[model samples]
Target: MLPRTSFPSAYRAAPTLCRRCLLRSMTARGQQSRFISTSWLEKQDEAKRKWEERAKLIEEGKIQHIWDTFKDRGYVKDLAGTEDQIKELMVQKRIGAYVGIDPTAPSLHVGHLLPLMPLFWMYINGYRAVTLVGGATARVGDPTDRLQSRVPMKKTDMTMNITKIHYQLKRIWLNVEAQATRFGYEKEPRIWNRAILNNSQWYASLSFIEVVSRLFKGMRLGPMLSRETVKRKMEKGDGMSLDEFVYPLMQAWDWWHMFRKMGVRMQIGGSDQYGNIISGIESIKYLRDTEPDPDQKLSDDLSNTPIGFTVPLLTDSSGAKFGKSSGNAVWLDQFMTSTFDLYGYFMRRPDADVENLLKLFTFLPLEEVSEIMEHHNQDPSKRHAQYALAYEVVGLIHGLEEAATVQDQHKGLFSKGGATEVSSYPTGGPPTANMASAFRVDIKLPESLVLGKSITRILYAAGLADSVTDANRLTQHQGAYVGGAPGQPAATNRGISTGELTFTPIKNWFPQDTRNFLVDGKLLILRRGKHFVRVVEVVSDAEWEASGMMYFGEPGTGRVRLLRDALMTGAKEGEGHDLSALSSPEARRDFLDRAEALYSDEAGRFKGLPSEAFMVKKTRARQILEQSFRVFARSGNQSAQAKTAAIDEVLERAARNLDGHVENYMAEKKRQEKKKIRTSRPADEKSAVRWV
Candidate 1:
């Protein structure tokens, strides 16, 4: 170690300021050792002194208001400053702001709402709002979500997704145009002003030198290393590329450009973006052309610049993130999520989150929201809050008229007072039966959404299907109603169009989860009930012609590696020719074939491991192999039955060791029992049923 005298007294002394004080001071001063204003320093000290008092007030509801109430509804925390910052920003300058969207898909999803809310808030509050479409960024996919790197898109595909996303946004925001239909006018919220922008407009025009100068001038490696996200990845010994490391830098550059060009002063995104947000503020302060005065010095505070805020992840009742039910995303585009399906999803949100959902995603006033909350609390079984929440959000997204129509259709067929079943909807759609006033979606019947499901299952959900015999004869004797018609004499092999099907009941019941089935647009809705809708948006003709998936009939590059590995593994294990002998492409095809065979042979044994192992590769394989080894350790080579018995024993023991920590827990429990339960029967005897 260096001599003690080498260190300064300040370094040796314990820190006088608390962490929050330090954070504030650092944010205020930012790299400067010198203080600016005496009052500012005093304010910091006061904040420290009164921290507990302010926290108590915040907890006790003294500071509660519309904004605070909104925050409680899942609005992000740690937005630059307190209420003082908001007042100051409003007084100082009319801040211009933006939210970024990458045109990676044809539609938006509910997940994208987090940033959109802030953009709307800024727009409504006397600030200029800009919606930045990342036409350029979409081509080079953002690494935020993907574990592996994304394949760079062709310029044409990028252009198409960008155009598609633009239209979807217009629908979401209810953009006004000459072609605006009733759906656009009556349902969707009109939030944006005149400033819809594409970052490609600026980024495309920049020279290489200009790009470098703007992005790299003051960015050093030290700060990058210190970032929590980066540090976490490095500590895990995971492979993080230069691009992954530099991604935040690129995002920071985007903010700097916006700040300089549009006077944008705030950035809001998911919690994952905190590092990028901080970097953006740093870039704005230090990289701008205007320099600080000779007398002025940098302060430590980071909160004084463009504000950074992040919302918590949305989760379902089971405490898992929303859209994680089956490990698939519920996309916002009509092709990805149907309007009716979307409505039903919001309907299923837990009562605990109704207020948060409204505050985060809707424009409901505080008083109305409170009333809805009270109604929900009074009789949760009534599902009043669920319907209202779903109706308002779906109307805002798809249009009020459509929502009303869906509701009317639902009531006509399913309501107890209405018809008990629906033979068919007037429009060409699914032949639905057993409709209910009480809305419930079927995730498995998009084909039958209003048309195709057997009347029995529809009635089953609606309490109509009583037994197998009742269902079988109803179809056998042509007694079943379909699209307002009696069942066909025999099951036909030919495919039936939507118009051809007829229902017997003829009463209207809203299409149970009919949200995905769009009637007019080329995009068709397919529902798996209320919860699962897949929107297949019509690709532009040009896009269709250019797509390899459309013309060549195959998935694109960078997706065949796993299939190839599987094939090779199967071949090696099966005493067949080596898959390695084939070219990479051929190997991939072979792997997919073998993998499919294996899947068909033993679905339960193969599905979980193959998908999981293929994705994570080496790490997961090692873990599984190690566990398997431990399980087989005591199972020596012997007759199949004896070996199997030994294996089973070892596995049970391992499971107990892994899941229950049985040995340690049992030892501790014995000690506790010996000390505490003196009069009881022997500890093991109570649980035992053994015979010697």
Candidate 2:
């Protein structure tokens, strides 16, 4: 820490003053301690000229050249500062801005998007960005914008949350950069870097007294108490704890630290943080003035000063806050909310808020936004603006391919009188690719299979549509859909299901450039309804067993190893733990029962591990187990009846009725299926009936 400047020795004994007033006459020692200059700053006149040009751009609200928002809708207003100050720091000095979020959860929802939009603007317009996750401050908890106080989070939980958020922030920045590249902005000489900062580094080491001295020494009780956040808490008279009151001070300190350490001058936050932002600005100003540095005189220009900007509270046309608090906020994580759901959410935005949301959430040019709004006005029902907004936002969050899939699914499914039924005949892409909206499972075709065979055999071999009796059962109702030749319209083929056909159809959904995925120069993709998809490669059974493929955990867990050993020795479950005994339906059922219990237990306790590494373990287990059951169910094995029965029960248990036809929530998927079973099935058939 730099000490305050003292008066020159010559004036120390003189009748009137302390060294604070005579800074210019400070000793050589004081001068060296206070001043350090960098080439990042420019000459006084040059910087001032640049500032003037930017200020004009700001006043005009024209992002024509610099592509930043100052007085436009993007600007909610600076924290009691002039627009010129904002422009000067952002444009002329090329300073960085930041928006700090506490890692209260694993993912960021739409509520965090508001502040990030401007931070994105700053990034593209040649400003640096440092996104701080409040790893330390989260421990103390911020009292702003809350009716009740926050419960403290465990260290492990906070650590896990930080890891997940760090991943998300990095992911978002990459997409932003890619967007920038398309805009030809990165070609400029400036290098853009997005930094992820965890606040624990500084705060974790400081003692309470040290914190008070470094940050709160200059904070006044009157002003702190008078702030809206504090006043509200006081009004409730819950006898506010010192921890809650100091929450704002922690945020203020964060800004001050960023300014000093990372050269981050602008603090961007939501409207709720207006008071905390101001507090930071005050503390920074006071510290700069009091820190005894001779170099500070060389930088008397206002460009070095810290400033802040706030985003207005975002809401929908209904006046409800655009947040998860209302239980409708969209999440960035796919597990919490699917890509299709996100697309639908934005695509159905009310006309009143679509334009504003576009400007705020997307990087589209305002001129283009205006044009889209015009087109939308001409035909509101066409939803031109809403579709554009949805595509852009979804593309940013996921990718262009994912967004395109949603659009295709929506258009294909809704084009026919809002029909949820899929065409028995191929409608969109190639017949095999038509099921692309659902899923992709990899399997192996029998080496002896011949081309131009039958589609029903392929479905059975892929463990897609259960038993022939089940398929017949489904067909007798409305008819169950299955993938085959693009032009074939049969709901189910009688020949293949009953083992009458020996050859298989070559029709597949696999990509044309498939050098990497092919086995024995042959790979097939199959689909059943809108949700179920399977991939089969033509590899001999002998070749598959010799391929050294073990589907289990890294290095194979003990259970997986035991199972593999049993498969080699044909030992029974408890006696030798042999997988060869898996032929027995009883053995298969016993193994699945135990495996199910183990997977459920691990999934239930996954949070006990580092979330970044283990969060998806349970989901993966269920998926692999489901696919495994299908492989066995379709195979030729001893004790056929027992094997088939055991495989069916386990597959049903693993799937939990998520088979292709069982629609969860999305109606769009219902329309993507190449074949539709419009008729309802018996309750037992609709559900995965118990066998054991």
Candidate 3:
């Protein structure tokens, strides 16, 4: 089907704990969440109940910390810094967990959900959330998902994108916090206290030399080069530049600064960013360990050392990525990607992907997601899992109201067997296709074409059976049925048997069927059998004339597309005189052949033709060809003398308009040169020349 257009982390125990010894002692966390109905009100109530149950688990030893619970639930991927260290720190303090986002676009897309959603989790779990806008990092684009370096954005464009993303991120973060607070999850919601920092502020003051020598003093060269993002680019022979190479260094500085200044204890990112996450953690540990203290009390206290973890990148079984660079991404901001478009993207999630996407992307309980999948699998056609996934993801990002609005619009399109209201559908297609099997009615035949036209001509114009002979053979079985109009009540009443199929007009069956056969004065749908259907639209002759386009079809179907190539072939020295029409496949092919030959002859001699001769002669030639075409179209007969007359008249007017246009072009060129010379002249010389 052709598309018309559419639109977390916890910290660990103190570093004093021996890493090898504690690795064996680490206990995986678990929690039970209550299931809620699809009702929004019930879901709100369920949230409060789940929080109460979570409190019990925390006391009963079923769960170590909320961050650990998240890790065990399969949210964290490529986790860096031990679980032992992170869990201990979370238990002792409410640490700030930060995720940095570069504002390369004015809006964030679905691909960003892997990293950005962690901030929401941190807030609901009573951890401080910091969503950083990488205003500076954006200037040096992230080399994470690109094969080639990005074209730099203008300052005004970058600033605009940054400001818009700031508002979008803040809005979602605040809404999530408010919802959690209303559920009594947190009396003093940490989300209200959350921070949205911009890295440009720090980078603006920090110099390149300072970053390399001081901040990166503890960083190793081997690890930086071995990072996956860097490795892939180098192996591909499209290696990253110095600016891109040091991007992680700047990101590391982000973590180091946040750890010391704001006390952010953890950094979270997508699987692709685990390498950068590690770099930040290492740089932070180095800075913290190097901090001078007379008592040396903090030396062994990995107590508050920053730790980092990554969320698994969502992928289909084929390993095609699902987020930002996946190419099929949708923007988070409603204005950029319309509400209907964003909702539809998730609602159409492939069955194989929906189950995993539900687990990774949404806040729904994993068990509930399983239940949704069971129901979805039972009736795959119903797409219950897709709806639930779309609902939660859309509600999370765009709020419940916007989500509901889009869902309603989507249902209205497909709920009643695809575009139920004929008035609402586009002239060229259904408002929304119900399935891939639905036939598209895209061809716009001239209104004049419908009157007494043979089945062969109709089929050819509609692009259904290829040629008139093919159309005739396909209809021989009497399997054709055509009806969908004011006079015809049923969907199929007409048929063409093999004996009556040859060169017969379809209007013979229903008498005046073609007069009102078009649904809403535009569409005609015909079914060849149970499996094949085609659509034809009757368009006014004026419309076709204005467009100048010969046909609407799939690639390689446009009849006149070869006109230029044919003309080029005729330009050979010995070929110019052989102007006879070579092929005659259709009624109009002869005229087309002659027209192209004439155009080629003129074009070949274009270099030597005079302005008056070229212009006056071509003007007359156009009139002759147009009149000949009209006569041929009406009766498929144009005399040889008429074509010769067109050639002679065209020669008289070909060059009439050419000289005036050339003179005007020369005058403009001279004016521009004078302006350039005056501007380049020295100030003193320019003043003396102007006075003279």
Candidate 4:
């Protein structure tokens, strides 16, 4: 009642009408605010429900959630979607996943294993696993985390790489399956819906116009420019090429194509690829949502959303990336990195990283991994965890049998005892105590060349010492041992006995029968210090003569020969030659000039030995010659001028011999090339035409 009097004019107006209008206005304002707030709350509720659903599914064992598995194993670094989204999609249905690899090199390396782990898991779980080889994109080269554009690969090299990579990919799958079976995760071979697809298959026919019209329209410049990689490049002021700038778009097209054609919903890559992966996800969404074809457009459902998973970039304990760019790639190819070396690489991993590496690399169970770490922590000196990790990984990449052989080789070569019984040999013979020669031979000399040779001469020929003088010095200090396994031999020159094996060490200088030194009448093991080992396999005269092995008197005579026959025969340069005729300086100079002309020829580039093999041989030859010069220059028997003169003469003779070998190599190459053209050409016109 007091308020009505105090309100005066307002209270005097129609109270009922005023009250009705006020209630109506308040309701209108309330509805607007409620709509805005409830929309946000609805989203929160939906998210919570999804999370609960995912958790329940994991609990009930409805699906092995990829997110949980990857995250737990340290495989995940970034994800394009929420964890709930990934879990829900995986739990709802079996989906397709892929990883793209550009065949920039001839082989995959250890760094490439990160993303492949998730793909492997998906494949075994009956998901479509597609390994997309970026044959076309390799030419463009991904600019992710790169400061400069990659050197463009030649078409011939690219083709060779693709072929080799295809073989490697298939081999990896087979090896992975075998390894998975060993880990008690067996799946039907027929259910493995894996494909090693070359992106060139699609890109070859896809014109630039098609790319702009179909892919570019869906991409936004804002996000592309905002990418961390692009931003970094711009800030660094390193000129970025258009090809590099549009690299993400090209990758986006790859994923979009996979999604539409193959139903692939997930893409796995390294963390550096997060920006590119986001681009891919966005592109998929844009295309699917705005597709012109009604049948092709995806339904507006959360399950249809594409996902991206990024694994942490593989790094060493020092935090350096393990990749070709870093120049520390451990190649997967046996020729590039031998099985023993590969095993050793893992075995040398630090104890701090062994547990994490085990989870990442091997398919071992978590409980077992914990047990291993527990045991390793107790006695880190033994490296039990590293041993298990190395064996498991080597077994996965190379077959289990090769793993076993490599293990045996490791123990025999580096174990406390020099000799270890091996079950197999590279020659595929019976078990042997000669494990050093079984797996690897440092040199192969003809029985005729080695049987009557002095120990110093043999050592020099084996490339163990720089010269005869160096060989004699090495023996004088007992730094050299012959006919013993490679390790600490017994204190006496008589022999070393370990278990049932007795190895005799010979350290004599004069020419004597080597029958007592040779093992099985074919193998001789030489040790320099505790680590450097040289295993010489003595072959039959016929085999050695067929090879490029040549003996040109003693090391003091400056008689140089090819250390590896692979340089000549493997280079398709025909058989060994008798270059004894080129002893005269004038004759050798004339031969060298002729050889130089062939070597400079463009065709000679393809016909000669592989560049790597030739470079290794040339480097070794240069090192030996330099060492010989140094030793002769320090000679106490001759004056400085006389020593210089003698060194010059030795170098000239060695050069002459090398020139003769080159001449023989190029001349043989020319002959082979001519023969090839002749054989490939059609017969003369008169021969092919009828003489009507």
Question: In model 2, what lDDT does residue 182 have?
Answer: 71
Best by lDDT: 4
Total backbone collisions for each predicted model: 56, 8, 31, 0
Tens digit of lDDT per residue, candidate 1, span 1-692? 32222223464344454555555655766666666798767765664445446445655678543245436666765564356665345334456667777776555666677677766655543356777777656655555534455566554345445545554565555422211343232222322233667766666556867656656767888987877666656656454677777777666767777776666777777666666777777776775533345443334333335765766676556765543223545665543565556666776778777777777776666678899889888889877877787776666565566556555554465332332222222123432211111112111222332243333444332322333344454445544333212333213212122222112321222443222222232223222221222223334545544553321111232123333344446564655554334435455444444544542343244332222221322333333323323323444423433434443554454354444443455566778777565547675875674422
List, residue by residue over 170-250, the lDDT tens digit for candidate 2. 667767876777766653333454688877767655688866665677778998888777777778745467888888778
C-alpha lDDT (0 to 100) for residue 299 of candidate 2: 52
Candidate 3 residue lDDT tens string, 567-594? 4354545434332333333523544445
TM-score of each: 0.47, 0.56, 0.50, 0.54
Better of 1 and 2 by TM-score: 2
Cα deviation at 519, candidate 2, in Å, is 43
What is the per-residue lDDT of model 4 for residues 530-626, given as tens digits with 9 covering 90 to 100?
Answer: 3234557778879977886564333323322232121123322332343444445554444444333332232344455433322223333333433
- Residue 690 in model 2: shift from native, Å? 40
TM-score of 2: 0.56
> TM-score winner among the candidates?
2
Off by over 4 Å in 1: 1-73, 80-83, 175-194, 234-238, 289-304, 322-326, 412-692
What pairs collide in candidate 2? 7-19, 34-293, 453-503, 453-504, 566-578, 566-579, 567-579, 571-578
Assess candidate 3 and give its TM-score to the true structure: 0.50
Clash count, candidate 3: 31
Using alpha carbons, what is the TM-score of model 4?
0.54
State which candidate, 3 or 4, has the greater TM-score.
Answer: 4
- Count backbone clashes in candidate 1: 56
